[model samples]
Target chain A: MSGLVVERATPLCQLQDAGRFGVRHLGVTQGGALDWVAMGWANWLLGNPLGAPVVEVALGGLRLVCQRDACLALAGADLQARLDDQPLAPWRHFAVRRGQVLDFIGPRLGARTYLAAPGGFLAPAVLGSCATVVREGLGGLAGGGRPLQAGDTLDWRGAAPVAREMPAALRPDLAAPARLDLVVGAQIGGFDSRSLFDAFNADWTLDTRGDRMGVRLQGPVLDYRGEGLVSEGIPPGAVQVPPDGQPFVLLNDRQTIGGYPRLGALTLLAQARLAQCVPGERLRLRARDADSAQREHRRYLERWRQV
Target chain B: MNPRIEVVAMDALMLRLFDRIEEDNLPWLLAARQRIVEAFGAALLDLVPSYTTLMLHYDVTRLDLAEARRRLAAALDGLRVPEDDGGARHTLPVWYDPRVGPELTRLAERGGLEPADVIRLHSERDYRVFALGFAPGFAFMGLVDPRLAAPRLDTPRQRVAAGSVGIAERQTAAYPLVSPGGWNLIGRTPARLFDRQRDGYSLLRPGDRVRFEAIDHATFLRLGGDDTPLAPTGRAAA
Candidate 1:
């Protein structure tokens, strides 16, 4: 089958599914879509499973041309997509004619966007996932862990969408700032009295030191009065306080285990919202219990299933 | 037996098990694992198991932490571990040639013995698989001889080829993949510890015993030493 060629690509673009699992004990981190909500909507436009394969483009600069007629969906950040000089919007499905051009520029709001075809993008699964992790040298197109580069082609086999369209209102309005939710972490109380006050009240700027692995929050270096403890299993969203006092919140590509005093993990939904924010964006940390967070999360997903 | 279940987080339960892995709790821990796994039959997340800890993570919306922990505790209380710990003593044949054991001479000097004496001492000591991390099927074996104990290399190599055995901080192990590591190279076994296509991927597990034997490089490359451990082991053509 004809495939989508990478007329222009960047180091950040790669094929991803939900992620590889059951291998953390082996020290393998789960590498998947950073913004899952956008990934799911892109797949939904093509009637694919929520976790179906999709093209994740970070910081834009991606361009593709349809060798043959194709139906596709674009979601997440609006990169000012255009088809042959015609403007295109996000969170909607669109059909391109043979030899048509689909180009992406800078993000108007979010940092990443997802492109999905009818069935899903095709790629070799390494360790049960096509997700890529360059640091670990695992997952990719051939499953040997290579990221997409210019002149590469991506293919799929599912039938094309019967129609093309996404809700106009649903178009991601990321121009407005994003607010992330947080569920209080396990070691939150171990923090010094002053740090706790600053944690919830003060605004922390997102540091430039960011990647799929984690993002360092530049703010008041939190101090822990608790005894020096041994390192433990770290979870995604864990706000770890290094000896230097900086707090780094581990993310999707984090190591299986870590040795640091952790403030706690952010809830899954919280991580999703954070995925949309760019470096330098200001964020405030808040606390929520597990029960209430779970309920809110369940309600959020229920609406997803109804569609 | 239930591991003093605690709510370390909202959607995940922390099972703080006692150390040393008592016989009675092993079964309970295994059972709790089974139940939690079964609960997320369709939406399985990560089920991370450690030496004395097991953490079950799931979609918060699907299963709340309180309910998951309650179910896990019940399973632990009612479960039973098989009488035997699934393990075996492994005697691995490794080639001690300088080309393979790059640091053998250094180890010999450090231990105040001839190169051959160092090999004999290494081949005699029994080791235990204390944990598996750093890579897939990579076993962190413990109790390397005190004379051979050393801190890891100051600068880690970009790639430590798989099957390469090394020592670091009283721990001995083989690299499951070609990854950057700091362990001091001692020798390499032609045996494959991790093969995805194999039935049980990892050859060694926690609580397993390991011993090293001396062999030549020729035997290391040949004898079907590669992964996919299915060939019948015959003593020799003789």
Candidate 2:
């Protein structure tokens, strides 16, 4: 197989696509790239479908050696990526010669990076997706939910297109403190007025103990005056307020169902932005209506339809 | 009764079908899920059926939230109660003993009954699979015999072996995979509740009816049950 070989990688590095869908009823989580916007752009640069399988590299420490000359795209989280000693900025496609090494040292801006090959690195789809969910032990290279490891070969079949660069204006600014748009619903009325006020007004810090399943937010102790709830299906980006008062945003790999009362779920773009946030990053939540958030998400997807 | 629709996100809407968890509500919820799935076609990303609600996650690129709600409401109007009686029926074999079931004696003592009474109470009636969650293949079956009802342990055990039958309050379930849990374990089952290679990936789903058949230790081993003694974890639960 003429492709790249993983020389070294952290457990965080895994193959991801759009996600596993239509199977939530089986208690299966939708696992995919946390920063789906970046994953889309990476595949877009390579002329692949927006949801083509791409490598989601978090907190760097991944190294690959090219076995043959090939072209690939990199997007999201600068991560201080380099090609055989040469610094490579993200949001563009680049070429690699045989025997050259691609190294991701560490995060410079965002916490996650996406790397896409021509037709997405070849991997058998498990549960209709190649997205890895380590908790469920499903999807990924070898179709066993394991992350990329040393000596593993990654091959793609599609022909490489010409090089392209994402417009600077379209790139997300990782430096800014993200203002996540929370579509308030669920048990919002159950929360006390004071806690609700503090929730939107005060800045929340991203807790260090965050993962693909969920991210804990430390800020105001949200008081839930509502009655206890029976377990129910949890949507992606659902901000659940446990008894502790601190809120946690459930992500793609979250449990299919939960009983905790939710303040609301983050808008699509806000979730993609939250995926790039590093621990201790200060952020604020802004309330948004469902219709407006829907329109904004449609507009974001429209970018791919245009040109 | 028509369910009240609540917008939970940009691409999601939760239909509140009932206020309490009861066997009577499952058919309507399952029927509603089927209707919405058919109504949305490719636009429906996922429809999750839980105890009292069906959460519909749609593709925003195809249909906006307002249109989704409108279409969902129309589809659910005068919904026909499914002719199929309470989904699929399954009979699982369980070995009720203190060897694999650490809480078997404790639960029996709490209920003022013998271990045999606890087993009989659990396996006597059919339970409804209300939902699947907490873990892959973990079917949340419910309505454990009120006499055998037990509370979840104050501290959850770090690992509950796969196929362990457990009870928490009125709900009862089997641990599909080895995972941390707080339920009162009463026995072990040989059946695999979840298999990725299986057609549905999960043996039980929402609306399905399940009955537990008490089995002997020798029968459990014959049915592929793991016999390696559960090492004493000094845990009060699981």
Candidate 3:
């Protein structure tokens, strides 16, 4: 069987797909690739489904040796990847010979990098997804919520397509400062006008206290006039404002429900972009409506199909 | 009833039935969820029902925001009392031992009652499952008897044992796994609230009713409550 043997692995490396859905009612969170667009593009290079499982490497400290000759695709963060001491850039598919060693040194452009096999890394589906959620202890190569480790073999059966590089025009510009689009929620009215102005116009720095679960924004203190909110279902990208006044954008692995007042939620594309931002990166939030956000997402998905 | 509909994200919308949780609102919310599932079918990704809100997660690739909103509004218009009244009622066996819950005495003192009386007040009422959240299969059930409505610990415990029953104000919940929590621990249950091997995984769900039944330590052990400490740091009582 065509496979790759893990040589050196980091705790951040885990198998991911679109995500575990329809299970949030059971208190299960949706865990998947933080940079979903990159994951999809990686699989697309191999002619696999957009949501196929792939290895999500964060900050890059993983190394693998090819056990068989196979074609694989790498997308998302330019993790300074190298194959047998030769420099390898992301957003392209390539072939690896048996015994060749692939190393992911560290991130250069973005935080998370996605590596895709032809048919996606083999993993048993748990709760309708192979999205690894360590907190929940579900979905991983071992059929349990564990990150990839040395000695673990990753095998995929799908046939590899002709090697190709992602078009330069199509590649997402990760170098630019991100302006995340947020669709103002009903609670937006409850925020003071000054706070609301600061929320959108102010430059917010990504706090060091960030993880897959949430990214805190350190900026102007948002004065919320609303009384204590009843705990409600918190969707991915919801910008929840805690008592401290700092807003945290909840991510894929966030808890299903929370009591923090929310200004709004980020657009899906913005969330994908936010995942690439490192700690202390300066970002601004742009308020958008539901219709435009939907259109933007549809356009993004359409581009994937066209590719 | 017109719900306050707002965009949760690009592909999800939150429908608020009421400002506060009410028994009557649950039926309509449950009915609305069923109608949405029936109407949207594959387009609907997930439905997260919480206190007074039902968030509908949909696939933007399959349906546009306008269409989804329209379908959701239509579904709400057709909402009626569910024939089954949500899910089944569950009777969970709980061990109300002070040895298992260290905070039981303190919680009882705050409520101006003995630990045994506090346990009695807790187990007597059939609490409605308001939501399942904070952790996997961690069911948040409600309206604890006023006498047993103790506040959460001032400082949260580093690790709460799995199946530990806790109360915070009006809400009571059983911890599905060993996790950090602030709720005042009162008892423990041997029941596996969350099991990955099980088909449904979560033993309790939203809209389900739960009644706690007092059990002896012997019965708790027989029901698979091992005496082994659950804390990873070995802080749990032996």
Candidate 4:
């Protein structure tokens, strides 16, 4: 195991890989880091596997002390982090000597942050993943769904150099406003043209009710005229409009089945962008077909293998 | 002739199980499941069979979806839900009294039957376990006597305790865990339907047949049954 001890960690922090998969029929939702792009880049900076585990920090305000000298990489949102009062930024690599305190006061940009160690964190894989799902009581260090509480120590078995920097081209841009590309679901037509127009043209505000399950978008009331549809398999990025006429884009932790009339799933690439938006963030929708959505999804997946 | 097959995306292909569920469609549903499992190995991420369709989730990164559809079409072109594999019939026990079953009175009235009559009619039907979804161990069983068919609550409860036995439309189900739900809760089952520690996480799977056996409070307490006995296991597919 690498020489590193966590003197302090917070509940909002936990080890995450890409996600847990292949068990949705068992009703298990895929749980992983929200900002998948950042998670990949953090791992890439350390020359580790693209899916290596990392600490997913949400809304910052986390502190950890390196008991043994260790090197680490930080990526994703710039959470205004510091090393024992020495200021540090994200999308770069850094190190802390023994007894040095690493603190993430808060996010400077995006809502979530990713911190990567050399070989990923040491945690047991529950059902083929270490991503934590507090609702399901699965994944994480204890292998029972729970977040990293203060005083918890995260340990990893792999080690690398003190620090390394990711190239400018490799870092993700957090300044760009989130624009989600949606593949107008087949039911898009079932919705009156008026609803469709608002779906793509109007800017929606991210509702605070959002969680891993789904994000409720506050915008023009979306209407889909149809007899209530039968319950069917729900996919990630599914934009379901409940009776209230609001659209909710289901995310990684969403249930496997639903019955509400769905506008359709947002492309996978759009899902990644949606993952980072903070509450009240303005989002514009762009319509595309399956062929175009698939192409963009393919291009996004190719980024990890490009290394 | 095969029903229309559509490509939802690169990783998912939709197999119209049927336009609507009917007696004849069960055979097609079962056979298609086996064919997909045999044909698609690592490429198949999930096989989601719903009321009238099968959504196959695959790895778009590794294999193209059109190819998957072709392969799946070839296997399930002409199939049906096979004869039951001679599985044992599980008789679950339940108590459907008003104190224990808050929704019993409403459901009984809707069915035009007394509470006991509704309970007896519900327990008589041997319902096939459709596919499990919504939540872990949440079993979506079938159309109770049509007379018992009820609409889902207009307002969903903030939290439906685990093992709550509920009926909605023609379907009856048990909630394995506490979550917001709209099902018309008729009773509560103390029997753990989904205990992660138990060897069987879910007792019902898709295609399994289940029957409920009505029991009085005395027997219910002896069996440690809550208002409804919802000892669900993950091993079975419903």
Candidate 5:
């Protein structure tokens, strides 16, 4: 019966989980946490399943008042969080007294933050996920694919776990210059050797035109020498080169089919890191073999399971 | 020939069956997809079938890239290409109202044909559902009579209403949701292409066959077609 009442909210706040799966064949995009790592950690801090529903607060500007004394977990971006006007850091579980106000003022470290309540937030599952996809009008508090707004109440029924703090070594290093690892795609060889060199060597800046759908990378113009390709299935993290040559990394909510030639797709960890990057953040690309990329992904999942 | 498997991402693999979309490729792609689903079972997170590629998404924790590739290869080897008897056929009733299709006259003019001829050409042939994308339940049906082939609008409309039928190049499809689109509008259908409340959210799936049937306005209303214009009425062209 414990809950938090939304006192203020921004359009960016929405409910998310690991994402909707097994439904992309129906032309429905996978909608979930942009930064899956952060969402998992937030849920882990509460002893909830990794895929439990949580509020994804992007660029902050959200305020909530505890309706009852309860425990919650915060992870991902710092977002300049404050508890009753006092600074509250992320990556740990904390308790709040009744009527205590939790305000996320703005971003400080990363672009997105995850807030998890005990047992996750109560939301109707549409297509086996509570992850809100506003484009499809599915999921969310009311289950109509709407973002959190003022005067809304978030209810959860599970009890909180023992307080815990994320190990310093395991905490994501958001301040470090991002170096994304990309697995070479089928079309990689079709790109001009010069453009391919620039794609890997040149520093790429994250463009301001980005959302849950994709993030455009501003860097060298990648000239694809391949002829026009028949439209085909596009996977998340696929770095597609448009006619203008700017590469955009598709994300959870990308269209299912596309015709653009892809340099490659980023590793899962790289995608998580990219999700936290703000506009204008500079990053470099590194080519990774398929074997190493798969091993690394497995290791990350194994660590989470062990934790 | 064996399908070429390419690692699309850490957890995704794209199996390119052919370079071009052809009727002969459907059976192989469909059989391969079925076999992979049966072989991997729950380990396969998602499988997306497009015109000529099948993207398999798996949980890296459950199956590594090498293991997934091996399993997929084994599955393909065991696949039995079923006869191409065609797929489920649905007769979709369409109301070819000129008021609903803002570009109907323009499209006919470009094709050097009358408006009625354009409608007849579109309705006479059965289209195959090649893939579903752009939006949920939006089936990309194909090979619209070449005579009806026309370029997309120079500028896309801000919003195309749900159920609006559209043609672009050699393809024809109906919009399942109100969204920005550049396809030339031709008619509107009443049948819901996508309904979340339904057992199957999408009415038409890949491999299905669909045919448009011309219907009078009264029949359109009888079949639950709302009189609402597919898009905002009287909107200036983009």
Candidate 6:
């Protein structure tokens, strides 16, 4: 089978798609590309489905050797990717010769980079998804929740189309001091006025202890006077405040249910941008109405459809 | 009665039926889940039923926030509890010994009860599976006998064995996978709470009723139970 052989990779490198849905009720979390916007753009460049499985390389350190002539798309963070000693940039699709080497040195700006094939790398689907979620022991090339490893071969079925490039306007600037849009949740009213004021007014720094599950935000100690909460279903991007008052934003791989009070959830676009942020980056939370957030989300999806 | 609706996120809504956890709410929650599924057939991406809430995740492109809420309200306008009894009943056999359950003696001593009495209290009542989270197939069953109600450990153990039957603050559950947990352990069950080969990849579903049946050591081993003692021996606590 025509494919690429993995010569080197870090643990953070894994395959992902839009995510696994209709399975949260079974205690399964939705795992996918943390920077979903990049995943979509990569797939779009290949003329593939926007949610097709792609390799998500975080803090890049991966090297692959093409086994056959293939056209692949690269998008999201500038990982300083190189194709056989030639400098390669993101947001574009290019061709590779058989036995040519592809290397991703390290992150130049963003925290993650996405690589997409024409029909998505071939992998057996588990629970109707190829998205690898290590914690749940599901999905991936082997359908065993394992990340891409050295000596593994990745192949796809579809034929590649004409090369394409993403417009500069569509590309996001993954710079520091990000302003995240947060849609207020039910527990917003229960927090004291001072806590609410501190939540939006102050700047929060991303902590080092972060992963696909969640990221801790270091900032003012907001207070919560709400009664004890019963454990309930948690949505992606939920900014939950524990008793200590420090807030943590739950991500794609977060547990299905939790009991902590939440200020609200970040908009999908904000989640994508946050995925690109490195540790110690400063960010501010901006309150956004659900209607406006939803409208913006629709507009983003429309871009993919038009493409 | 209409449930309180909360905009959990831009694409998610949580319909809260009650503020507190109650077994009686399971039936209503199950019925609400059915109506909500039927109401937003294709638009609904996921529906999660918990202790007193049913969280719905919708595809924003298919339906707007207001339209999703209107459909949910219309479907639940005259919701009725199904005439049929709640969910399926499951009887799980457990090995209640100190070796596998290190916290058994402490929990017994804290409640001023004999070890046998502790097992009896835990096994006597049928608990309802409220929700599943923390790990795949980890069912959060609840409403334990108040006498057996115990608070979670001040510090969670680095690892809790799978199939460990435990209680935490009026809630009872069996660990589906080995994970970090703070629940007070009372026994270990031989039954596999989670199996990937299973239809749903889980032995118990939300709304199911489960009862624990105490079994002898030999019986436990016969059912493929592992009797490896936890790191910290129960004798130390005893």
Which candidate leads the pack in TM-score? 2
For every candidate, what share of the true interface contacts is present? 0.34, 0.82, 0.82, 0.36, 0.83, 0.77
Candidate 4 lDDT, A45-111, residue by residue in tens: 7777778888898778778878777778888777888998888888777777978888888767887
How well is each residue in B115-137 modelled by candidate 5, as lDDT tens digits?
99999999999898888999989
Candidate 3 off by > 4 Å:
B82-84, B229-238
Q: What is the lDDT of residue A77 in candidate 1?
A: 82
| Global lDDT of each candidate | 0.73, 0.90, 0.87, 0.75, 0.88, 0.89
Model 2 quality (TM-score): 0.97
**Candidate 4 falls in which docking quality class?**
acceptable
True-vs-predicted CA distance for residue B89, candidate 1, Å: 5.1
| DockQ of the candidate models in sequence | 0.31, 0.82, 0.80, 0.43, 0.82, 0.80
Better of 2 and 4 by DockQ: 2
Clashes of 6: 0
DockQ of 5: 0.82
**Tens-digit lDDT track of model 5 for A1-307:** 5489999998789999989888888899898999999998999888888889999999999999998989899999999999997888888888899989999999899899999988889998988898888888888998778999999999885865655667878899999999999998889888999999999999999999998889999988889988888988887799999999999999988998899999999988999999999999999999998789878877787767676
Q: Report the Cα lDDT for candidate 3.
A: 0.87
Q: Write the per-residue lDDT of candidate 3 for residues A42-135, one digit (tens) a residue.
A: 9988888888999999989999999988899999999999999898899988889999999999989989999999878889999989988888
TM-score of each: 0.86, 0.97, 0.96, 0.89, 0.97, 0.96
- lDDT for each residue of candidate 2 in B16-90, tens digit (9 for 90 to 100): 889998888888888888889889999988988899998889998889877897899899888888678458999
The CAPRI quality class of candidate 6 comes to high
Clash pairs for candidate 2:
none
Candidate 6: lDDT of B153? 84
Model 2: lDDT of residue A112: 95
